[model samples]
Every structure is written in structure tokens, then in C-alpha cells.
Target: MTAPVAKLLLKVFTYRQLAVGGGFLAGFGYVYCGIGFALSALPGYIILEDHFQDQFPKALSASSLFNFIGIAVLPPLLQYLKTLFGSREAFILFGAVTWHMIPAGFGLRDAVPRGGCIDRPSVSKRHAKTKRDLKFVNKYLSFCSCLFYHKNYAILVVTEFLSSLIYISWALFLVSLGTSAGLREESAVILSTAAGVGSFLGTALAIGLFHFQKMNAYTSCAVPLLVNGIGLVGLTFARDFNSLLSLTLLTGFCLGVNISGMIGIIPSLVCRYHFQQAVVINYFIDGIAYQFGGLISGAIRDLYGSTLYVYGFAALLSFVALPWILIWACNKDPNRECEPDLS
Candidate 1:
């Protein structure tokens, strides 16, 4: 529902005579788009978990592959449009393209539980009125409590938050970072697209590893994060376009494997009843981390006049999560670790 409105907003007021005001309107439109994406994606993951069962990893990998394909394609496509048509026309065309998601979204069906729904105790009229009044607050508290119900889950949440914070900060600034290193705008864009291509390839690799090697989810996620962090730190030494492109490709590949593992790990980390909650909470953390990441990275860039430090900070945070990942992986009887305490 909000998809067309969000696109229409971009089409109407993105860069007209409104100037700065138009920028604000575009920002507002992006907020709507973000909300729509979160709403759609969270449910989609839950649906995949419920329906795909053992095949969820492949399903998710395919989804990630397509996602990066768009990431790989869109920038160059937009650049081509801007080259031929004017900038305004490019944005307008882009907005028109986004409207397709509305129809695509219509095809999604609600997930049916593999074993059917579990019944919960019903409240009587006397207690219902009071419970209804505090429902929102109570639900919020319940969700928070569930986050730490198991040690592995708690670790996953923290790791996810840090990962989101680190990755989002650098990912958003990749183009600017390339430009800062003396690459032309077109070259920088190509550099960004290389990351997407790398991600697509990496996800494909993960799918193969999942089937053939029977890779451990924790190891898959943790190892890539470790590699990506080292790669980002090494990125500071990159001087030429090729060097920067190579490092970005490596980091993007790690990012794809790490994310595929992260999403696939959720089912193993929590019970079926909490799957939706886990997805919601994970994305909620992502949204919060994204806002903080932008502010932190921008502040460092503004204060120091360098994007290198931004990647440096991201690298630092990425390393900080490694210990927790190691701890989670080393823990004994991992499958039994997710079971809720009933005594």
C-alpha cells in the first residue's frame, strides 16, 4: 500500500524548485520505503522458515542472490538513464520501476504453521479489559524478555546489532570512500557494483557449501565476519581503483555469506513460536543500528575529513563481535541450547 505512495513522493518533489525542501521530501519518501521493506521482508523470512523447512537455506541463498543482482544492476542502470535522459527523468523512471513491488507483494500468502497453530489460554471478561489496556506495553516487555531466553540467542542478537552497525556504516559510504581515494565518479560507481557482483557470487558459493560441505552456520557467519574485518582494515592501504575494488569485492563477498548464515541460523536459535518475534527483533535492531551507524560515520567524516576512519571504526566494531561468535560456536550441545527452560 505504501509502496506507490512512497514512489509517487519521490517522483513529485525529489528535486524540483523546492531545493532543500525537496531533499527533505525525498528523505521522507525513503523512510516510507524503508518501513515498507522491513514490513515485507520480515514476513517473507518467516514464511520461508515455515514453508521451506530443510530447504530454507537454499531458498534464502536464492533470495540473497537476486537481491544482490538488483544491487549490482541498479546503479549502472540508473547511471545509464542519467547519461541519456536528465537526472530528473532518471529518478522519475526509477520511481515508476519501484511501483512493480506493489503487485509483486500481492502474491505473498500468509505462512501456515508446519504443525498447525498452538492454542493459547483465553482470558475471561474480568481480566480481558485490564489486559487489553496494557497489551502493547506487556507485549513489548514479553518480546524483550524472549531475546535473552537462551544464551546463544542473546549472543546472536548482540552480534547482529554490531554487524549491522559496522556493515551499514561502510556500505553507505563506499562510493564516497572511492571518490576520496581519487577515483572518478563513474569508476567509483563501478567499484560499488563490483561489491554487488561479489555478493552474488558469494551467495552462490554459500549455497554450494551448504549442500556439499554441510557447513556450520555459526562458523560460516563468524569466519566471513572475521575475514571482512581484516579485509576492511587492509582497505586503508589501498591507493588505486583496482586495489579499492578488490578489497570491496572481498568485503562484499564476506557480507553475503555472513548474512545468509545469519538468517539461516535464526531457526536453529529459537523455537517455532518465537520465529516471527526473532525476525522482528533482529530487523528492529538493524534499523536502530543503521541510524546510529550513519550518524557515527558522518560525524567522523565531518570532523576528520576522511572516510578511511569510517571504515576503520567499522572494522573495529566487526572485530568486537568475533569473540562472541567464537563463544557461541564453541558452546556444547548447541541444538539443545535453544530449548526454553520449563522448570
Candidate 2:
């Protein structure tokens, strides 16, 4: 991390992430649930870059607003229907009946496809059409690269890259870290579940932390980085499952805190118009970073036993982001009132 990045973390990164997280969970639901069915699910979430907010507030706000509305309305709406109908049985029965009837009604109204003469053109003409469509989309998407040059954009870009690199290794290694210490698969699952429980707890803690000081995004990230590092480093010497699980919870808590703060922070820093672009870019960075990590972890693990070096390397990469955040904070004026919506 460079000095400005470090400084920025303390002053700006926290609120930025908080802003982004609000929309990220809701807008990103498709990624979470859809991908779960398609791929082996990971117990995790996504973090957008902090700088994207600087350029895309309107888009971000719209996304976040809908999410806020959904969270507020969904539970109550379901409960209201249940109560109004006087029982869960009636509520569900009606819903099931509607599901079948609505589709059946549509089916009843459907006009079946009527055969027509082939509209297929020659191979050369078809190839031309495909080429034109690809060129059009690629040209439009290239406009998104404007975000790449801004310093704020770069900071987010790097953090995501580093976070992904670190997370990929940490997640898989966590299993072995427990099992090697005599944890059975069930125990490991329970321990992972414990960490999941701690995730919500960590979010609660972030609320209090925010109340104590403004933003504090970088410091919030730093705290978790240090805690997770210490825990994993300790694991190199730990001989039992309970200790491993305890450390796992500690790390999970830190992760939970990190994600919550990050979501809250990103939108605060960017303009609403750029929100969609920023989100897309953030994911691109994360994807590239994780691709590198997968190869690195396998190579290291294959070359050596479960050792301190691999974990240490991951910790060290996280540390790389700290200085940039700190340096970012140092250059900013100390006494300005914060912009709204960042908290």
C-alpha cells in the first residue's frame, strides 16, 4: 500500500464500503444464489472498489434504494399475508394454487408457433451479422476503461485484487487447517458454521465502531487483517480442532466486519451515474486476482507441506494494501464535514 492509500482508508474507505454493501447484497443476489446452484458454493460475498462511488452515485443509489425497500418490505409482506389469511396453511396453499394457475392461464392463451419459410441467409452474410454485433458491444464496453486511470479507481482495483488473492487461499486452507488438527468433516462444518454465526456478530460490532468514530474504514480493515493474520499464524503451531475453530471464528468475524464496512463505503465516494460501471470493474479486478491465487496456492502447497510460508504470504499481501490507504488519508484535510449517505 502507498501512503495516500493508507490515509484514504482511515478517512474515506469505510463509509464508501458501507454505501456499496447496501446495494451489493441485493443487486448481487443473482450472483450469490444462481452461482451456488451452478458451482460449488463458497461461504463468502463480493466487495466493490471504493473509488467507483466517486463516479457513479445515481446508479448506485438506485440499486441500493431498491435493496433497502426489499429488505424493509419482504418479511412484513409475507407475514401480513399469513396473518390476513389466518394461517400458514392457507397462505401457502393459495400461493401454490396461484403458481400453477397463473402459468396454466398463460399456457391456455399461448399461440403456438406457425411454420414459416426459412429466413436463413448465406454463410458469408451470417458471419457478417455476428461480427457487427460483437464489434458494437465491445466498442461500448471499452468506454468503461475511463475508470482505470483515476487514483481512487486504482485503490479499489488493488484492494479487490489483494483481498481475492488472500481469500481464495484462506478459504480452502481453512478446511485443512481444521482437519489436520484432528477435526472430522462434521467438526469442520460446525466450525465453519460458527464462523458464519460470527459474521452477523461482526456486523453488529461495526455499528458500534462507527458510532465511536467517523468512517474509520481503513482501520476497520486493518483490525481484521491483523486479527486474521495472527489467528492463522497461530494455527501453524496449534495442535487441536477447538483452537482452530476459535481462530476460524475470529477470522470470520473480521471478514464479516470487512464486508459490512466495505459495502457501506463504496457508494459514498463515487457519483451515482458511474455506479454500474464501477461495480462491473470491481468484479473484474477480483476475478483476475483470484485466478492468480488459485495457481499460486496449488503450486505452493504441492511444493511444500501445510506450512507457515503460504499463510504468511497471504497475510503479507493484505499488508500491501494498508500503506496505500494510510497515504490516502494523510493528504486529505482533517476537518471537513462528511458527505451524506456514506455512513
Candidate 3:
């Protein structure tokens, strides 16, 4: 709902020239976009996981395919719009593009109604609170409590937080890094397109691997992330277009795999009842980490006068997250197949 509004806000704040504190306003708009994403994505992910459990990975990959395609295609198209129209008009057009999501939202019908013959209580009714019920400082205590119910979930969130902190910076700064390395603005845009193509290929690869390969969740996530870190570090040494393009493809491919694995594994970490809570909590933390990462990256660029250091720092974080995933995989119970959800 707020997605199109964010774009409209961007259009307004950026008209003629950037208004004072435009950067802050732009960030605020992105926050709404993030919330909008959470609202839509949570249901889509839940629906896919619940209905297509056997082929969830491929289904998720298929769903994400168009996202990568948009990433690959939008930059060049938007640049053309900026050249033909103006920044303000380009934003207006993009805001119109975002409006399509409203109709898409209408198509999301329930996979199975809760009460037909079983006479189940409504979700709100089931969880209804009384004045006597224990309360916390906020309404999110129940969701937050789910994090500690399983050690795997706790580790997953930490790994996710650390990885996301670095990943968001990579996506936001990739173009800046390209321009800093003496590429033209158009070439930098192409570099972003290359990354998107790489991500698309990576998603295709993941779909194949999930269909044919028998890798566990930990291996699926850790390997791609570790490679992703190396790819980021490789970017520091890429002085030419071809070098940067190749490395960006590798990095994006790894990112695609890592992202798919990250979300797909939630079903394994938490039980069916708490799945929605887990998803909400994961993305909420992600929203915060993304903003924090951007600020940190911006500061590093300001201090060192180079995006190379920013890329290196992001790589270091990937390395840091690798160990946690490995430790969790090693200590995972051999006898028990899955953890029981909190009742």
C-alpha cells in the first residue's frame, strides 16, 4: 500500500532540485517500501512454503526470478527515462510502476480457509488477551520470544543480521564503486545490470541444485555466502570493466543462492504455528540492519575516500558469519530430525 506512495514522495522531494534533508526523506520513503515489502512477502513466502513444501526452493526461486529480471532491466530503462523526461518525471513513472502491486495484492487468496467443518477459532480469537494476561512493554514480545525457543533460530537470525548488514551496502554502493574506479556513468549502470543478470543465473542454478542436489540448509547457505565474500574482495582489485563485470556476476550469483537459502530454511528452524512470526521478525531486523549498514558504509567511504575498503569490510563480515553457520551445523542433533515448536 505504501510502496507507490514512497515513490511519489521521492518524486516530490526530488523535484527541480533536491530539497533540504532530501536524503533523510528518501530514507524515510524507503522505510515504508520495506514495510510494504514485509507485508506482501510474508504471505507469499508462507503460501509457497505451506502449499508446496516439497518444491519450496524451486517455487521460491521461480517467484524471485522476475525480481532479478527487474533489477537487471530497470536501471537502463530508468536511466533512459531520466534522460528523456526528467528526474521528477522518471520518479513519477516509476511510482506508477509500483502501483501495479496493488492489483497483484488482490490476487492473493487464501490457500485454505481456516474454518469449513472443523470450526477453528479465528487467529485473533485464538490469541486474544485478557486484562489478566501478562504484558510486556510492547506487542512484539511474543514474536521476539520465538527467537530464543530454538538455538538454530537464534543462530540463524544472528547470521542473517550480520550477512544482511553487509549485503545491503553491497547492493546500494555497487554503482558508486564502479564510478569510483573510473567507469562512466552508463558503464556503471551496465555493471549493475550485469550483477542482476548474474543473480538471475544464480537463482536458476539454485532451482536446479534444489531439484537435483541433496545439500542441507546449512551447507546451502554457508557455501554461497563464503563465496560471496570472496567475490566482494575480488571487486577491490577489478580495475577494468570486464574484470568488474565478471566479479559482479559471481558476487550476485552467490547472493542469489544465499538469499534463497536464508528464507527457505525458516520452515526447518521453526514450526508451522510460529512461521509467520519468524518471518516478520527476520525482516524487521533486516530493515534496521540495512539502514545501519548503509550509514556505516557511507561513513567508511567518507573516511577512507574509497569504496574498496567498504567492499573489504563487507567481505570480512561474510567471513565472520561463516563460522556461526558451521558451528551450528556441526552441533546439530543427529538423532532428532526437527525441533518441536513452542506450545
Error of 2 at 108 (Å): 27
TM-scores of the models, in the order given: 0.81, 0.54, 0.81
Q: Estimate the overall C-alpha local distance difference test score of candidate 1.
A: 0.77
As for model 3, its CA RMSD to the true structure in angstroms is: 7.5
Model 1, 1-343: lDDT tens per residue?
A: 7667656667776645446765687689778888988877877777887778787777888888988898888988998899999899999999898777777678887776576443443323433553465466456667554454446777788888888887787688888888888988888888779889888888887887766645564556678888899989988779898889999999989888877777666767766656667788888998999988888889998999998999998889878888888887886644322212110
lDDT score, candidate 3, position 294:
87
User: How many residue pairs clash (N, CA or C atoms closer than 3 angstroms) in each of the candidate models, in the order given?
Assistant: 0, 55, 0
Using lDDT as the measure, which candidate wins?
1
CA lDDT of every candidate: 0.77, 0.53, 0.76
Model 1: residue 151 alpha-carbon error in angstroms? 2.1
Model 1 alpha-carbon miss at residue 313, Å: 1.1
State the displacement of the C-alpha of residue 65, model 2, in Å, after optimal TM-score superposition.
Answer: 18
Worst 10 residues of 3 by lDDT: 334-343
